[model samples]
Target chain A: MFAPRTNRLAVLARDWLRRAVPRSVRVEWVRLRRLPRWILEAPLMARARVEDPRRDYPICLAWHESPLQRGLFEGETELERGKAINVAIAASRLDGVRVDRFQVLSYHHLVGRPSRRRGFAPGLELHAGEPAVGIGGGCCQVSNMLYLLALRGGMKIVERHRHALDLFPDRARSIPFGLGATVFYNAADLRFENPLPFPVLLRFDVRDGVLRGELRAPEPPDFRVEVYQEGHRFAREPDGWIRENWIRRRFSDLEGNELRDELVAHNRCRVCYEPTSTQTDEESRAAGPR
Target chain B: MLRALVKGAGLVAVARVPGGAAAYRRLTRDVLGTQRGHVEKLRRVVPGYVEIWRQTLERPLEGARIWIHEAGWTAYWPAVCYRLSGRAGAVTNCEGRIHDQYLSRAIAGAIATEIPNDLNDPRRIRRLRALLWARQSDELFRTLEGTLHERCVPTNLPLADASRDLCHSGGVLEHYRPDELAAFARECRRVLKPGAIASHVLDHRDHLWHADKAYPFLGHLALAEPLYQLLHGHRRSLSYHNRLSPEEVVALFEREGFRCLALRRLVLPERIYLDADEAARRGAPGLSRRYLAPRHRAISEADLRTAAAHYLFQKS
Candidate 1:
């Protein structure tokens, strides 16, 4: 939603200060303190194994990467560094991770907060409904990808947070915005509880400049998961308009027969960009909700 | 390696000739049949109505009331309307006389044939795609006359009571404002008897995307509302600019007392740019600055963007 308007001079002054200090320097100390934590967390990393499998994962559990990468990590250094940190998370926390029945895969409990000291670079991030730069800024990207894999892999999500607003444009976007998960260090995390009888393997790796990940188990999933957006609209709030969407989840049998489609969550996020599309059909009218 | 060299030499030889690209295109279109559209060929895939009953209706089309608005001049929606409703007591076709006649013809042509719908009822589409394949197009047109009561209206329809068994619209509601659409929906609801159905192909894409590739589908959002009206509105042009996303349309239907039965939306996956400076140059600078609104830039992107939505709703 829209924020209160500040005086132009104040806006300019704040921007000048922001530029003077630079976000990298501003968030450095916050990340530097994480160094000791990272060291202490080293033992946890060893628990997650990174390996190249001698055999391929089941085709059903394959990961697909996105070609729509603009505005996600715009700068080259930030982009490469974000990817490096993503690989680091895959190596140190996600790779070879296993979950037995009823066991939870707590994102923060296992991987910990992505820290600058852990070698994360400044990348695109959302702060207070706006895109901003921060240490381990794009850590949410990895978590989001993992969240999707877990869902499709039939893992039960015990806790997840959606971004306040969809910041990226739709042009060539790979997944629906409202379907994503937003992680903020230890406070906001993604946790999945395995419901299957067998243990499931969580794997992540970089493939051709894109991050590819998957959930592998001996048997194909019994219930299939597909996520979609529904009832998406821009609702006017007191301050400004925020985009609203319902992330709908559909379950199907392994044989590809649909069982039911249910509403998973209602995503209400700030609108951070102009929503314009051509009107090709007849103009139609709508009344506000009754 | 030898095959690669031969292929490269062939390409060089073609490049050496004048207008080879044009010639190749001509050959492709003429020899490869690119210019021809296969109504007959398409029929093989979708099959016919008569088979539309892969699933049965609680209310059969027989002696039912139905409405098909903006069926267009040559569209075959009436075949679908009639097949589902069958010799319905009454049928309403909005878009005037000629459009109604076309509907009548297609329905007649399809009367004799009842191929089972080939899709096995998995993909959701109501109308028969091969309604008037070229081979049967003329016969279908000649014998379209039927005894069922048929009415045609050009714009706003005038009808009363819970009379219609079914009401349908194909790709027409996207041009009206949400309020006008809501009114139209109310009209359908009023005319339809309780438990009747309303269905549509509800296309929500920016028509200009395929019309011209100069900009992203969302490029029109860069211009201020006033400027957009100036160019595409009835003030200067006949084109209507609804710019309503699929979600907005669904919301409108819901508000108008329609229960969603089925919604299969097509998501477009493409990133488009609408920069602030670009928007300013395209429209008024001051308005463009507002277009870039606080903390938001000219560029907007999202995945699973609904290009079009196909839905069925039952009147409550």
Candidate 2:
């Protein structure tokens, strides 16, 4: 369902790099090690590419093009996936970066599923989203998680938005607001730019129900990078359940200090108590006296 | 006036006469002569804060570049000339009266609430006035001495042939009648450089009068009553006919081509009022009024909200 889409993304990425690099700047392409399941899996295999391989540039990775891209992942035709990837290519140009290629490893089956069910396996427990038939329900987390990794790697953010509410209570490992990415065709997108002079290698892998991202670059100088929280809270209420969260951030030595804070969402709820028909012995005795 | 004069003379006669009926009349004449002598002595020494009548004689002469108004008594003009121009400058009575001009009853009554029985007595009251008036005149004369020809004139002439940067009159403007005020404003405008800033601390509508009117109920009461006439007898008020409101003062400045900047009200402390009252009891009414009215009978906060208004202006 997603294989041909991955190949089309790779082709679109190639076309993007061909057009994005300024004629004055030289361009090169390099391939990183590919996992077998990510590269040759049932639905689609993942592949990575680097632009300006000789000079250092930050690498950005995303799961799908848009909410419309969800249709492609759900067994939509190659033409539909092509259209979605084209929108991403056009959007990526806004940041002055080339979209090399996005590799989709498999359909995220756990998406749109509730976090708990009776007797559900402990390892297979889905942590985000409700059990519902949808296209882009849980895909935001993948992009959100990736966005945090990019920010921590000291990459310049191009566009991002916080969730309407926090879906996860444990935000220590979560992406900060203005740091998380959201992409819906022609509506929202996760974008970043490479500010460094050197090329950055973006490596992605999913293990033990966790998605991990790694950035590889040539060592410039021995400078320390620290991530600090500014102690801000963001509260979100989904339906009737309330969740409070915080944002995490990183600071680089060259840039002095940086702060990450979250905005809280307010909720209004009212409770009304009604009298019951039951009468106690005391009430009955008081009634007789009255 | 006759009763006061006769009773005053009779009191003096009683104080001096020690013998029979014939001596009484003789004592009366002697007391009257003594009173006249005291008046003459006062005429020679009591400084008047304003000299409105002397404007004509003190007109500036040719080659006079700086005109200092109100050269206070005891205002060491020689020292002032040395300090300002390193040479002597012409000294003139621009506005204020010499110490001798304020010797009469009218000026005394206008200045002090209590007239001492023996007005000839020299005390701190007389000395302080002389000192202050002298200080003021000295400051003015010294500032302009030797730099420019001095004149004791009321003419509103510009500082001709000299580059004028500042045109300031601290205690001079409030003495002007409405027309004089307007003319003074015009003169200041004519003399000052464009965009020059003028700082003036002027009393508009005698602070005591304003306080009295603003807090009529309070002014009649014990705590605030004594403040009513406190500032009434100062030479600044007696020498000047018109008292302006803050708004009117600002309007006058604006009419003279000045833009208003800031207006601040300063409240006199209680101790100053006590000192003035004590001085008034000692026979210096003007000094007493100058210090007391703003201190004691001055309006309360609520009254201030109603009566208080002062302004600053820049020459446009």
Candidate topping TM-score: 1
lDDT of 2 by residue, B124-223 (tens): 2332222221212333334334332333344445254223433334345655666777876676666655655454545432323432333221121222
lDDT of 2 by residue, A165-275 (tens): 333233233333234454432224454444333445554444433444455565552233343333232222343433222333333334453221212212212111121
Can you give the lDDT of residue A256 in candidate 2?
A: 51
Fnat, model by model in order, equals 0.00, 0.00
- Interface RMSD, every prediction, one decimal place: 24.2, 44.2
Output the chain A TM-score of model 1: 0.71
Candidate 1, residues A1-290: lDDT per residue as tens digits? 23544576679887898889966565565567645644443332214432533253343453645421444435556555665565555444677776654355767767765666766666667875687766676667678878888767766566798898766456765665576788766556677666554667777666555666778776665566787766566655787656666676677766887654555567778766655543111111222222
TM-score of 1: 0.38
How accurately is candidate 2 docked according to DockQ?
A: 0.00
Query: What RMSD does each model have against the real structure?
Result: 29.3, 37.0
- Point to the candidate with the largest lDDT: 1
Off by over 4 Å in 2: A1-290, B1-68, B74-93, B97-155, B205-239, B269-312
What lDDT score belongs to each candidate, Candidate 1 first?
0.53, 0.36
lDDT of 1 by residue, B26-133 (tens): 443332433222223223322322233223235644545555565234334445444544422233454322222233233323343334444123221212222221
After the best TM-score superposition of candidate 2, give how far the Cα of residue B316 lies from its true spot, in angstroms: 2.0
